[model samples]
Target: MRKKYLFIGLFIFAILFTFGCTSGNNPKDSFQKYVDAWEKQDYKTMYTFLSPSSKKSISEKDFIAKYTNIYNGIEVNKISVAPDYPKSFKKDSDGNTSIPFKVTMSTVAGNIKFNDTAYFSNNTKDSSNPWSLNWNIKMIYPDLNTDDKIRIDKTFGKRGEIKDANGSYLAQNSYIESVGIVPEKLGADAENSKKQIADILKIDKGVIDKALSASYVLPDMFIQIDNLSMDDTDRLSSLAKIPGVMLKKTPARVYPLKEKAALLTGYVQPISADELKKLSSQGYSKDDSIGKSGLEKIYEKQLKATDGAEIYITDKEGKKLKTIVKKTEQNGKDINLTIDSNIQSALYDQYKVDSGTAVAMNPKTGAVLALVSAPGYDPNDFVLGMSKDKWNSLQNDPNKPLLNRFQATFAPGSSFKPITAAIGLKTGKLDPNADKNISGLKWQKDSSWGNYYVTRDAAYNSPANLLNALVYSDNIYFAKTALDIGKDNFINETKKFGIGKTLPFEYGLDASKISPDNSIKDDIGLADSGYGQGQVLMNPVQLVSIYTSFVNNGNIIAPYLNAAKGTPGKILESNVFSQDISNTILNDLTQVVSNPAGTGYGAYMPNLPLAGKTGTAEIKKSQTDTTGTENGWFIATNTNNPKLLVLEMYENVKNKGGSHYVVPNVKSIFEQFCK
Candidate 1:
C-alpha cells in the first residue's frame, strides 16, 4: 500500500511539470504579449519582448520614435495589427516560429493595408522571457527600410464660380493688372514715390508704411500695392510712370459688376489662424481662402472643395517605391443665382448719390430678379488686398455701405396702407365704397389720445374712402380702418402675412414685424401702425413677398434665391385675402398711380398701365418734432402683365421730393424691362 501511494503522487507531479514547461516556451503566448503592448502603443513593454540581438541593434527610445514619427506624419488612425498564427506550433530549421499578421490604418491621404510575418525565437538569454521577437525597421511597414522616406503630395482644388440668371459671371477666377513697389528701385525718391503710389492707388500712407515694415521685405522684392481695373488704363499708366512702382498681372477673384453687385456676391480672404485650427483635420491650411459675407458665406462649404493628397515612400536616390495612400481632388460646384444682371445694373445706376436698397422679383414665380444696395464698395478691392485707408473709408462712411439693407427692415409708411386695406376688407371692418365722412388734414380718436394725430396732405380731406384714400395716401383714412380691425385681430391677421416670422430664405433676412414686440399697445399706436408707421418695420424682400399676393389672387408667393429652385405658385401665405378683397385693393392701387392727384402718379407711363403706392415714412421722436427725416418708398408693378414687381426705398429723402424721388426710379425700371 505504501508503494502504490508514492507512485500515484509521482504521476501527478510529472503532469504538473510538463504543463509549466509548455507554458514558458510557447511562442504564441509571447507574440500575444508583444502585440498587446503594440496595440496600447506601450513601446517599453514591447521592447522587453525583443530578442537580445534586436535590442542591441536599436535602442528602445529610437524604436519608439520611429513608430511615432511615421504615424503622426501620415495622420494615422484606427491602427489594427491582427496576427494569424498556425493552430499547431511549427518550427523552422533555425528553431524559430513565424506568425503572419495583417495591418490596416486610415490616414489623411486614404487607407493603408499590408500583410507581413513576425518571427519569434526561444534563444533569448533572459530566463523570464524564453520566447522573443526579432525586431527590425521592416516591422514598422512592409516596404520600409533604413534611409527610406515618407512624403505627402498635396493637390489643390479649383474654387467654384458664381453666375447670374443670364449666365453672366458675377464672380469668377480671373487675372487683374496689379501695381507693386520695388523698395530698392525707389532710389533717392523712396518717400516721394510711396506718396505718389498711395495717391494713385487711393490708399492711405500708413498702408504703404505697413507693407514696407514686413520682416521679409527685401529692397529688391516686389511688394504688391493694389490691383487696377481693366478700365483703369489711365491709372495703370499713371502708376507705370512712378519709379519703383512695378506693374504685374496676378490671379484674383474678379467681380465684373464691381460696385453694382458687391453687396450680393461678397468676397473671400485668407484663412485665419482660428479658422485653420478648427478645420485642420478637414485639410484646410493657412494658404486657403474663406468667404466672409453674403451668398459666398451662405454657401461656403459648397463653393470650397476638399484638397486631396498622396502619401508615398521613396528611397534616398529619389526613386518611386510604394504608394501608402492616394486621394483624388474634387472641384467646387458652380452656384447659379436668379438675379438679372441688367436690372441689377440699372437699379444701381440710379443710386449714385443716395443711399437705398431695391428688390426686384418675378411676381408669378417668386424668383428674386435683383437685389441692389447703393453706395457699395468694389468686392475686388477685398480680394486684391484693400489698403487700410480704403477699408477705413468704407467703414467710416455715414451711408453705411457695409450694411446689407435688403435684409434689414424699415417703416413701410403709406405703402403699408394697401396691406391694411386688404386686411380690413377681409375682416368685414372696412367698406370700399362707403365714405368715412371725415374732413381734416389731421385728426385723432377722441380726447383719450394725448397729442398724437394721424395726418395726410391738406389736398386730400374730402370723401374719405378706400379708393380715394389710397390715391392721395390719406394717412387718417387708413388709421381709422386699423382701429376698426381692433388690436388683437389686426396683430394676429398681420402675422399671417409672414410678419413677425423668419423668412424661409437661404440668405438670412430680418423678420418683418407688426411692432417692436409684435403688439399694439394703444389706439394711437394702432392707428399709426395702420399707415405703416409707429413700430411697423418690413424687410424689402418681405414687402415684395406680401405685395405679390395682390397679383397672385390672394396667395403670397415664397421668395427664392437659387435659380434651380424656381417653383411657381409656391405659396408662403395661403388665402390671406379673399379674391374679391384682393381685387378691390388692386384696383385702388392702380388709381394711386394713374390718377393725376395720386401721390404715385409721377410713376405713370404713357402706354404701360401700372399700379402702385407711395410711402414717406417719418422718422421722428414725436408728431410735432420738425427735425425728423423721411424715408421715401415706391412699390410698383404692371397690372397688365404681373411679371416684374419692384420695391425701392431711399433714406433721408426729407426734401428730395419725398416718395416722388423713388417714383421715377421704379418707373424707369418698368419702362426698360416690362416692355
Candidate 2:
C-alpha cells in the first residue's frame, strides 16, 4: 500500500510539472519575447513574430521604413512602460499570440488631460470559443512606443454632412470600389504597352508610366480614379486586364456638382515633398490629405476624417491566424452652407465664357444667394492627383482662375458711389438733399493740365440729391463729397462698411482693397470714389454690404458663408450695426429708378420699389491697347422685402462696355429671382 501511494504522488507531480512546461511555451510567452525583441531593435526576431500574411503583404524592409518614419516623428518623448501591464494576456482567443503593449500616454487637450484616449482595440473572432486576451498592442496618437497606424476608422467617428439651403448636396461622402495592379506580376513587356493604356484612359503617357514604375506602389493601381462616369470607367477597367492588375475597394471624396462651385468649394491638391515635411512637423503622414484652400482649408478640422485599422497574426501557409491588434479611424465633421446652388449654377451660366464675378446676398440677413468666379476650373480636376500640366495651367493663367473674385478686390469704378454716399451721409459732409458742386483743383506740382482743369460743378445743385449724384454718377459731385468728408473720416467709414479691410467672410484675401496714391489725381480719385472709382477698392460682397446699409436703412449685417452652425473650422464672425439712415436719403434712392429723368430709371424692377447705382471705371492703362480696358458695374436692392442684394460687373467687354451692359443682367437676375 505504501509503495502504491508513493507512485501515485510521483505520477501527480510529474503531471503538474508537464503542465507547467507546456504553459511556459504557450503563445503568451512568445508574445512577451516579441515585445522584448522590439524594444531591443532586434527586428529580425520581431519579424519572426509577425503573422505570415503580414510578412507576405508587407516585407521587413517596408516594416522598417514605416517604423523609422514613425520613430522620427515621435522622438520628442519616449513613453515609459508600467511595471506590470494591466490585465494583459499576450495570446489572442485562438491561442494565437498578440503584439506586445504595456504603457499609456497622456496629453493636454483644452481643459482635460486625455490618458491613452486614442485607444487601439481589436475584437478578433477566433475558431476557439471563450477566447480572451491580456493587453493588446496600440498605435496611439503620436505615441513613440507604437507603430504608426495604417487604418482610417470610419466606424469609429464620422464627419457631419454638407448641404445647401434647398437640401442640395454640395459635398458628401460615399463608399467607392477601386482597382490596383500587382507590380511583381507585371511582365517586362508590360512597360511597352504604357502608351496604349494612356491613350485609352485619355491621360498623359508619362503620368501613367511614372505611376507604374514607382516602388512601394501597386504596379497599375487606380490610387485615385474618378468615381463618376460609368461609361469611361467600364471601358478603362476592361483595358486594365492586360496582365497584372487586380481590383480594390475603397471610399473616395466626391463633389457631385463639382463644376458649379469649383472655386467656392475649392479643390484638393496633392502634397508636394515640402508639404509632407510640413505635415510631419504637425504629426501627420504622407497618406493624409487635409484641406488646401476654399471652404476645405477654412474648415479642415471639421472635414478631416480618418479610417481605423487592425493588426493580426497569420499562419505559416499565409492564412490569418489572429488579429494581433486593431484601432478604428475617425472621420471629419460635416458642413452646411447658405449657398443656393441653383442660383450659383445660374450665375455661372451668365458668365458664359466672360471673365467676371457675380455675388448675391440677402440684405436682411446677409446670406449669400449665389457666388460665381469666372475662368473657372472643375474642382474635380484636383481630386485624383492633379497632373503637372493641369495644375500649371491653372497656376499660370493670368485671369487667376482659382480666385473667388466674388470676394476679389478691384477698383469699384462708379459702383462705389453708394458707399461714398453712405460715408458722406454718416459723417455729416453732405445731406441727401444737399447738392455739392464739382469744382476743379490746382495741382501742387504743375503737369500737362497746368494748375487746374477748371472743371466747374455745382454744390447744392437743387436737382442734385444723393440719388441724383448716384444717377448721373457725377464724378465731380462725389469728389467734393469725399473732400468734404475728408481722408481720415472717409477711410474710417469705408472700413466700418468692411471696405479697405479683410471681410469677416472667408472668400477674400488678407490684404484690403484700398489703393495707395497721394496726389490730386487721388483727389479726383476721391471724385471717382463717389462713382466707384479712383483709389477706392471693393469686392462684390462689399457692394452687397454697402447697398444693404443703404436699402436696409443704415443696418449692416455681416455676410454668412454657411447656414449650417456646426462646420468644423468655420465659425461665422459676422457683424451687425444698428445705425439708422435718414428717411430722406432712402427716399431719394428709391426714386432713382422710379423717376424717369434719373440715369438709373432704365434699371427699375417693374413691380418692386428698387434703388441702385451704376459705375463705369476707366481701368487705368499702362498700355496702348484699349481692348479689355475698364469695368462695368451695377448694384441694387429690393425695397419691399430687402431680401436680395445683387452686384454684377463685367470686365474688358465688347462695345466699349460700361455699367449699362451689366445693368440689364442685374435687372434680369433681380427680376427673375426677387419674385
Candidate No. with top lDDT: 1
lDDT (Cα atoms) of all candidates against the true structure: 0.87, 0.59
Give the number of colliding residue pairs in candidate 1. Answer: 0
lDDT of 1 by residue, 376-454 (tens): 9889888877767778999999989999889899998998998899889989899989899878678999887867678
- In the range 1-675, model 2's lDDT, one tens digit per residue, is 999999999999999897765534334455556556555555566665555445565677866676555444323122333223334435445555433344432111001111331111222343221222232233323222233242211133444456778887776654344434455555677675555555555677677556666675754444432233322467557656665555454444556676668777775544566776555444334456656777777776677655344443343454564443354566677777888887788777777767788888887777887887886887655655566777899899987787677766777776676667767776778787765544333111126434433121223344655767665656666767877887677766766766555666655553345565322344544544555555666767766665666655466666777776423222222232224553555566666667775556777866887777766666755223355477777777788867877787788654644667777777777777878
After superposing candidate 1, which stretches have Cα over 4 Å from the reference? Answer: 1-146, 177-249
Q: State which candidate has the highest TM-score.
A: 1
